[model samples]
Target: MSSSLLCLVFLFFTIVAEATYSPGGFHHLSSLRQNKKASKSKPKLPFETRYFPQNLDHFSFTPESYKVFYQKYLINNRFWRKGGPIFVYTGNEGDIDWFATNTGFMSDIAPKFRALLVFIEHRFYGESMPFGKKLHKSPETLGYLSSQQALADYAILIRSLKQNLSSEASPVVVFGGSYGGMLAAWFRLKYPHITIGALASSAPILHFDNIVPLTSFYDAISQDFKDASVNCFNVIKRSWEELDAISTKKNGLPELSKKFRTCKGLHSQYSTRDWLMGAFVYTAMVNYATAANFMAPLPGYPVEEMCKIVDKFPRGSSNLDCAFAAASLYYNYSGSEKCFKIEQQTDDHGLDGWQWQACTEMVMPMSCSNQSMFPPYDNDYEAFKENCMSRYGVKPRPHWITTEFGGMKIETVLKRFGSNIIFSNGMQDPWSRGGVLKNISSSIVALVTKKGAHHADLRAATKDDPEWLKEQRRQEIAIIEKWISDYYRDLKED
Candidate 1:
């Protein structure tokens, strides 16, 4: 359609979006599409109104001395009526652009929401530059960049947006994936009144101890690997034995990683399901971790296997090193409460992903090597440092601390404040909400899909799959509209 006609359609819908929320006061957002359209239009105003570009309004800030930044995107909502007066926070400390500006991936949520979409560059990266250059230079300064601090920033922006976006307080929705899931759950808990609802998907909210629900997750991954890979388990078994002897050395990762690149155990053929965790585990392995009574870093997969993956997808150069870089970043750094391992020391076990849990933990190392060839190359570590890192950094204050997960503390806060919660997850999504619904608060509803990968379950890497990913996102938007209706209209129990 013509640009002029598109604008008119958007304006007309903006007014209708509000009424859609309260039709008959029934709490049934999922079924609201069946309801009739409201007979109304945005009122004619005396003053000239200015609208931001349909695209996102991006901004950044520097608050510390490490390697992170605070960033948010002002996403225009697709409200048929001018009802949304607030912003929606995507899960965790992340680049809000993915939720707002990355129109392609954020499929459903970004386009239609008229309310601003705020993406907070995690406290240490992107344009939300906190602390100056060399912020990640040491662990002491990196302490300021934690989940506690990032959550505080989420609240700060909500208030700021309310004042600037409009005088009226906009009902905000905290949305996100995996680590973002943690952010969404906790944000609603702490600032229940400020946020209307949260769409927390595939979040690891329950503590590591609560991981029992997903105990089969690793087995599921290993089984898939073994099914497709020839003697993959034997290779890993050998690697573990070797690690038994060398795993104690703090500086041994370099030597082990070299061998891992060529190890046959690592060479196993992974299926679509294996792709989820094998990819994610490799990322944590790159850093260091001690998990499941193992004493070795993840055995490196086969070089040919890694190479085949890189070849299947297009690349800027042949040097395309690791096949699992994006998966690694998504699981480890996930932008929620980012933790750095500035200086790693090994005990009985070498480095592991579990280090983030220890109160005495230091920041993760941020050398260009860890994130250089990261996918969506626009966010490589080099760019991360250039775009966000600030000068003077502050250590985290106690107030910045976040709540833990014995219960649906975060989701509960959302409903207490009168918000309808919707969590979106892919049934096969590995690192995210693949198994989160059973443990979440009953008040919150999850939107589940079967054929998704990570990040709302679309396959973005394969050659013939981008189109499929796009169509999946389109479907997600319609789901969001339905959810809004269910919350605002059908489930009036609130």
Candidate 2:
């Protein structure tokens, strides 16, 4: 194979290694169901699942443009009053039900504001497949799946729903976490006339282009480990060298398979490295103050737990052994997974759709160096382009996101036109490296907490929530309340 092909292959392995722990709400659904079964008093689901007919191609004029698909959405009008604010959770890469269930902040504060709750599923995900399940069969069908198209879908759906409910007078506020957060913020920017404001939590809107350092992501992960324990960070940092030395010895791959308790034999050292990297990265992402099942069954302060395991390793245990034990905590925390699988498979259509998006417009660059806890890797755009072309017959538009979303001079542009948007980020989330960390204008605000995890503020409040997290949510509620109050005051004046 050519050098470019080799690079692409390496990149693919790296992505596949991490695919098992990719962020989404699907896992939360299973957890929620389990919790519900355990409860003696089973409560009715908060929102009613509904479908909306959406255009296949929102930006095109071709025959395919007129085609329609049934997009899934959930609605709860229990707290809605006449002329009440409409709170919409812009769906991310997974099922709308998952988001609606996990995003309890919207429901928690709905009654106080008398807001109507709506969560819309993105196209090609959940049951919103534009061409049904065959949408992934060809590039032509998958072409309809893009952020721009999804944003348009939201704008049109909000308009239609308002008209149907005679809610044209109701102010719309969009809420989303992670990628959905990006959509929520972009929705307000692109269709300000449609939405009064947006609460975008953990949204890395500036991750595209060269707006932030490519190393910012891995650096954040490294910092999380370093903060937990320097010794733990050093052990992980030196692990790659130890792994390389071990793999070159006799029966090395088999020894690794046995040590890690892999269900399947190890094929290459790179896969092992990728698997370990995924554990560290994802553990850092969901290192909540309280125990969380977002990625897997993890204890409260999972990073610290992993560090404690690494710090208290047996006297004769090898670095590789310690690493496996820590990683096991992430993958097999429930102690049910008999053996690790280096390769992972998912039936999530949303992830399949996300793969296409990552290849196309959502091309955020990430790399690691000596400064990071993981092994060093450079951001190779050419290699990424070759990989995307090989898989999808298209080149990634690295600059499209910046062009379409206004990444350059973002503060200046958004400060001028943006209003009533909350950019809330938890410092521990690696994605926060690319988030807006400060206020852009009086109306545009950023709420950042050092102890926060990925979109922790957006998750349901718990009895064990840290006081800081509670304060963060309280601040968000207050800001949103002001926006609604001001909107009504202005409407009365008009």
Candidate 3:
């Protein structure tokens, strides 16, 4: 009876083991053991800490310019660990001079965490010129140049990084400011797996579609012009509005870029650059779109100009300092003058309109030289307004002004995305209108700075004599990092 029982028990155990195994017996047992080990072991996180040269390399995605651009990223240090998430940076429309001065930056955070910093010429402006090629031809062509495409471009690059490392590298985190902020938000939304996190500084995530908030801009800009004083900015605002109301009729008067483009050196003859710059900044704070983008989220402007300007800008600036890069790029040469020093320009920012009477009256046009900024556009206005209103989550309008061509709206296309999104606005930014924050809904997390400006004026800062600016930048960054980390925590994969 004992022998029978023992034999039966051994047979039963053998049968149970075989039934659970993958059919090849001991070889199957070997696999089972591996599975048990895998279950117990922590799988490797996705990235590697690779050091890049302090000088970030830039090349045209197309064959045109054969031109070279030095997309700068003052790489800090490696991430703290051997296998932390990769950090890759891509920003919106800025020229190399921005890197030369490191204007509007505070990326020391990247190295502190062992992130890789890289900057690319956002396709058009800087040395990233598609000079010889008609790469950015029409709006439809420009529509192709989207954040969706940018995600593809970035993913391709990250895959190359993964292949080079020959390891399961962690995901990347994209960082940007202004339009770059828009890109960062769209990139994560478009490809969450590729980007584990993102930090958007002074980015107008909510204003990409419309920017009528400038009715309030005159006050803010004027107040700042006063150096936190009372009368300083007020005097300038009083003079500016009188002229702006008039200019909006002729050549969309205050839009300095188009006016500057047409008038060139005589910018001072009509109005000072201060009014133009103020209008440019204020109009854009609420509506950050390419000039032509008034019509659609995707634009009829060449893709390069697609990260549109919310308001039409005159091509040049009165402040010689802010005018050079764009002037040089478009006219293909800088005029005899250059940008005045920052301190000098800051002073100039507050001067009374009475001081420059003749110039303001003369250079300005009573006509819309740049057709896109005014009525009777080459493209239909009503349709663009409808699409734009829809894209930014505004109540759709049957008609407004626009000939914009992009068909995809954020609500229609981007709303499909769940969490994994972030946005930013500057408290001091004239454009951080209420509409932008209201439109995006519950899925996106937005960051606001205490004293930030139109863009990441804080991200671009190092040490501030006033001290207030620097602290604000830090708070902005912390908020960004927290949102990103939270996003990563929730979707860290199974």
Question: Tens digits of per-residue lDDT for model 2 on 253-275?
Answer: 99888877777897776666666
**What lDDT does the true structure give each of the candidates?**
0.35, 0.77, 0.34
Candidate 3 regions exceeding 4 Å error are 1-82, 96-106, 130-144, 208-219, 222-227, 238-417, 420-422, 434-444, 457-494
**Predicted model with the maximum lDDT:** 2
Q: How much does each candidate deviate from the true structure in C-alpha RMSD?
A: 18.3, 4.4, 25.1
The 10-residue segment with the lowest total lDDT in model 2: 4-13
Instruction: Give the Cα error of residue 123 in candidate 1, in Å.
Output: 1.4
**Candidate 2: pairs in clash:** none
Scored against the true structure, residue 74 in model 2 reaches a CA lDDT of 88
TM-score of each prediction: 0.48, 0.91, 0.48
- Give one digit per residue, the lDDT tens place, for model 3 in 1-494: 01001000000011111111000001111111212211223233222323221111133345432333222223323444434556555634333233213323434565554554445444333434332225443332333333343445456556665565553454467766544555565576666777766655444433222333312322343333333323323232343444445445655533544434433332332333332332322222322222211111121111122112211235342323232222222212123323321111111111111111101110100111121121111222343334333333333221111112111354554455545455556555543442134334555555555544544442333342235545545655565566556655766764
Give lDDT tens digits, candidate 1, residues 1-494.
01111000000000111110000011111111111111011223211222211111123244322233435344444442344534454423222332333222333333356544454444543334344544444545444545556666667666765766454334566666555655676677667767756666555444232233322333333333343332332233233334434434565544434433321122221111122223333322121111110111122232223233444445342221233333323223323323212112112110111112122211111111111121111112232122122222222121122223334344454445433455555434333322345323445655555433334331112234444445545554555565556545643566
